[model samples]
Target: MKKITIIASLLALSATTFAQTWSVDKAHARLGYSIKHMTLSDSEGNFKAYDAKITATKPDFSDAKFDISIDVASLNTENDMRDKHLKSADFFDVEKYPTITFKSTSFKKVNGNQYKLVGDLTFHGVTKQVMLNAVYNGTQENPQSKKLVAGFTITGAFKRKDFGFATEAPATMLGEDVNLRASGEFVKE
Candidate 1:
């Protein structure tokens, strides 16, 4: 009986000290991107529907894993015609590739509150390794929900041609580089 009680206590303690899972608060998150248009202006857009989760064993999140998926059809740039064109065969071809996903390979601390996130990004029927700069915006307890939450801002850039995305578009019409930015609050799960 005594041994059983001790074992149970240890298990409880380990559970609290081990890996923790966190889910993004969709209402407080944004997945956005920007690209040069006509070599003159920048066109910006965002995916309204997406999901992300994080797993971490360290308090500082130095050993964290991240997974995210974005609904390709949920993209919006506030211009219906342009958005439709972007979803067509000239670009994303949403019907063929309905989602864009990323799974982290490594998360290494670069400096105070900064980290390098290396991951495999699958987009437009292609997968490639990419690195993003991450800033850990810290954690806090929600005043109303009383749950622990963490904040992060991740940014990266990739060439559209590299992913076979709208490869036919000339640089004079649409720039090749796509800049990505995601920021959000994640709730402990």
Candidate 2:
């Protein structure tokens, strides 16, 4: 009976190992996107620094775990003036808040190829629950890096005012609702 129990335990452990997990390979990962400003065309940009970790029970992503960290101080809008404006207290307040982050609170498979990701997003100094229309871009192995990687894209909007961003432009200029797009690529450690 003891031997049988030990065998069962081993099987359970091995089964758990079957769960696929990927670590963020910063060199190959991207954490960025932009939104339309002035109700005109979308302005493009990206975060200079970020990391992520994701785990999937299978490629379908029915069962998964996800988390990401972004250095708020790394916001680079390309233009020196715009980047300075974004880092100010009127925006992200890089001096006060050095980092912004998101961690999955829950996940649900909404459809065959879509998912609802519920997570806490921290910005400025406030934490808010944000839901994302997420997509599983699937998984692959990089022959060069020899690392297993998984990718995802998340889209949502946030109230910059909620995080005390730009006290001056709550209604104009920067706009209150900031569009957010996160694309992450994680590799197996």
Per-candidate TM vs. native? 0.91, 0.82
Candidate 2, residues 1-189: lDDT per residue as tens digits?
A: 999999999999997888877787667556665655666666666788887777667767777778788887777778989888778766667898998888888778998768999889887788999888888788788888777777778787877667666667635345557787777677776
Give the runs in model 2 whose Cα sits over 4 Å from its true position: 1-19, 33-36, 41-44
**Candidate 1 TM-score versus the reference:** 0.91
Residue-pair clashes per prediction, in order, are: 0, 2
In candidate 1, the residue pairs with backbone N, CA or C atoms under 3 Å apart (3 or more residues apart, or in different chains) clash, namely none
Model 2's TM-score against the true structure? 0.82
lDDT to native, each model = 0.95, 0.76
The lDDT of model 1 is: 0.95
Once model 2 is optimally superposed onto the true structure by TM-score, how far is the C-alpha of residue 145 displaced, in angstroms? 3.2
The 10 consecutive residues of candidate 1 with the worst lDDT sum are: 11-20
Q: Could you tell me which residue pairs clash in candidate 2?
A: 23-187, 90-166
